[model samples]
Target: MNRIQQKKDYLKQSLSLLRDKFSNIPADKSVIHKVASPLRLEHAKGIVADAILKIMNDHNLQMLALLVNSCRSEVVKILNEYSEKYFKELKWAVIDEFGSVILKLNTNIATHNYLLPPLLDDLEESSESSDFYAKSTNYFSAINQNLLKIVIYHWRLFKNATEQGYLSASELILKSNVSQASVSNFIRYSLEKNYLLKHKIHNLYKFNNNCLEDLLEDWSFYYKNNYGKAIRFISYDTTYSIDTLLLKVKVLRDHNIRIAIGGFLALELQKLNYVSDIPDIRIYTDNIKYTKDELDLIEYQSQDDVTGRKIIELVSPKAEASIFSHIMNKDIPICDIIQCYLDVRHKASRGMEQADFIKKSVLL
Candidate 1:
């Protein structure tokens, strides 16, 4: 198909998908009708905006600028009779295509609605500490330590059951192993939190929205500001070998954070392809020798050099040395490392020791 026909087809598909997803809402009919017809005027504006985006991507910026100007002239003509609110809403669709285009035109665009006064008040009262681990622990503890585990388990079960087609209340109870009352409570909670939906016909539960994406985005922002510039204290061992460490490294990089690998894995990192892609990687191995080719095998890259910092290696005498001390000496924060260590220690002491320790810790 030609470019113009392709653009029209895409818009038709998008409108159809949106209507199908929102079939439950009564207002969706009006929304769908608006996209289907040019009576709203904004419908044509959306088409023009989409076409401009295609041209922008296919051609040079200079050519795109001219095309945008031509489209803007036509858009202004169509929007002349529309009110500011209607125009503003139409501008949102335009901004979605080319953010710079909207900004260049100097349109008064408000992307997100402002938070309610109560929410703003709560946020203001919350402490503004750069220590993410401490803040996360405090937030999770306030809710209850086991809440995350329960939520994650339910979330996984909901996803798995949905993929398999449908699930019954009995199936949910069996998979989660929670009391009937608790299951009902979690279902209500998930609905309120916009995490899960109920399929009425199938009588099954499924993820309502992309909660995982939001969770990962939240963590990414938290880690970037808190630990991106710091040297990480990794407890590497035979169990946590180079392969396992590489997975963690990829996760950190995916979140656009830079970390210097420290501990036993540092030697193993130097023996792999850590340098060719992740040249900023600094290995803190105790006199381990590696060839340049081995260093060249590491495959990782920073999203941007703006947040990148040079890596420094600190040699330690023991294999399992106090890596935290070295990190502290370097003036890098170690709250995340400390919290991780404590978490591991708690998990290891899981029987009566855990119960006794928890009681003592809480009592104190």
Candidate 2:
């Protein structure tokens, strides 16, 4: 598709999402038509701005509630400047994109009416052609995955060092196996964010212990942002227990499968015994097709699918090599402590409990 067509389609999808979110409120089709019109393609920014203004005017309360919860600082500033009454309502809307609750309205309103945050997120993801639209919905766009890798590398070094070690860009590039450009960017960002304390006399960087919590929080979002939706299969093997399945998978190591175990199974492998019932087994691999083909011999999609079966999640991450940056236990490969924490923290099935146990007992 042409770029213009793609942009129009994106605008239409964004409008459709807004309609789905606020089903009770009738959509202003006139404003939507103006926003989605191919003839007005050159004036995309103006069209979007006009559409937002119209939406705000039409559904003032809903727009106000969403803006207050938005991560875009500029949007919040504009809302505060124009609508002072919503200032009091701001305190109740202190929720992030990943949070379960966004806004707490005292009045009776449909819960779905104030879902503009996700719509804004959609725009931020799809509207890269226009800087105006992108900046208007900018939400945690600063979190860099390369920075996450560098942070992990620094942490690994920090734990073993007798004294706090200072990081050099060249040394970082060599140790982390990241590109030279990425290392330079990470150092600059770290210095600005105080993730690293810079030496006054020499150009050296040391990891700031205080920023560990914040970095981990960013890593959680990075993990979710990248590998949230994974390709999974329900392995209905009534023949083998979860432990037995682990053995079956481990034997495939000889086939040159780049697999690292994660989720509840990783914790179990460490003999942490934090969880009694494992919901699913998560695996990170560079080669999905190969992994699936080999594992299919033991358990594959069959006509006899049923409930109470084990789930196997096959996640292909952008950082394929980093997934294997783990410590082995009893010949079982597992994702490192930090990766495992992020993998299970956001899960709904008592995952936070397990993650908390890891954080307090291991990470802390």
Candidate 3:
């Protein structure tokens, strides 16, 4: 029922599934690694897919192993596709019996020199190499919270700038609330990654105008992996509709509850509508549990229990700073263009089309 309990339940279920499948694997051949999903919900799929992709590229890791839980088929497929397309020499073993992975390195195929020291230690300590099941704990280890905030600050400046206005490094550090050392480090990293170009004008070090699209995506991905945990529920009442949900949300807002609309419903309210059916409503707040109590929402025992029912998702943005920048629409607060776009970009329901429209019509 609570966040910690839900996580414990998920880990227990996951480990039980893994043990049954790997029981026959030679003790010498199999290793078990314990991992926690970034999101609290078990049915919240693809939480680790992006992490896995980043690890493989960052560490030049090879020989991926997969344990295919019935619920994780989509994530497994994505890992398989990415590995095949990028690393032709990489190996994949999808164990159907165990819904987990064991990373058994084949020294003959994998190069010893490519194995990074820190990663090797983590693997050795865990005695597991199943990249699919293991948490990519260090995926965003190098990125700082201030770095992301600085990027977002620049993005806001770019959006409002009437002309090519460049800020000096010192000014950037002062306005973005970051340390001088962090700004220096960010300048170095951005230049190296080709995200920004530096120019010297009138003895001032200024950065060239670089589009924040890629940087924003990176920020969103990092935020999702680290902070985007949500408490979701489905209504047992079949008569409750999207319109009804909006009315209730408006009531919560009237009571001074700091709630903002997000996801599909937010997009529709912002007039960037592309999807025909509103599958669910996403609400962003600082304290979801408190808000849920205010809204009198019930937590469903299982997703299967309420098939074809209206769902409500309550997410608390745990980022150091607020990314929503929400606008009040007809007494209802809704997330900004960037937040709405990022929220629905990966959804199954025409999410790409909606995101494209926002880019062309608003962001571009």
Best by lDDT: 2
lDDT of 3 by residue, 1-364 (tens): 4433433334444434544544533231232222332112242223234444544665534333333322233334454465556544344333311122322234244321111111112232333433322333232333344444444446555745633344567876776565787666666545543444555443233332343444444445554555656778776477767777777778877777677898888988877787768767788876677777766667867767667677788887654234333344757778767667777776777776777787677665
The predicted structure with the larger TM-score, 1 or 3, is 3
**TM-score of structure candidate 3:** 0.51
Which stretches of model 3 miss by more than 4 angstroms?
Answer: 1-164, 169-184, 202-213, 220-224, 241-244, 247-257, 303-309, 324-331
Global fold similarity of model 2 (TM-score): 0.59
Tell how far residue 145 is off in model 1, in angstroms.
Answer: 11
C-alpha lDDT of residue 241 in model 3: 70
RMSD values, in order shown: 20.1, 10.0, 13.7
Ranking by TM-score: 2, 3, 1
Report, for every candidate in turn, its global Cα lDDT versus the true structure: 0.32, 0.54, 0.52
Query: lDDT tens string, model 2, 1-364?
Result: 5444443444444444555554543333433332122122334334334545665565433332221112223232333443344232221122223232233233343232122223233333345434433432322233244445555556556867734566666777776676886566666645644556777766767776655554565456555655547777765455546676667568766556778888888888777648788877888877877787666623435535636566788888766655664445537778777778888888888988988898777775
Best by TM-score: 2
lDDT tens per residue, model 1, 1-364: 4433333334333433433433422231222211212223366667545534543454322111111201332333444334243333232221111111211222453322111111011222324322321232232231221232334434544544544544455676665454676456555544543445677877776653344333322222332233323232223222434454456444443443333344223322323221223322334333222211222222224434223332222222221222222232222222122222222222222322432342233211
What lDDT is obtained when candidate 1 is compared to the true structure? 0.32
With candidate 2 superimposed using the best TM-score fit, by how many Å does residue 338's alpha carbon deviate from the native? 1.1
Q: Which ten-residue region of model 3 has the weakest summed lDDT?
A: 111-120
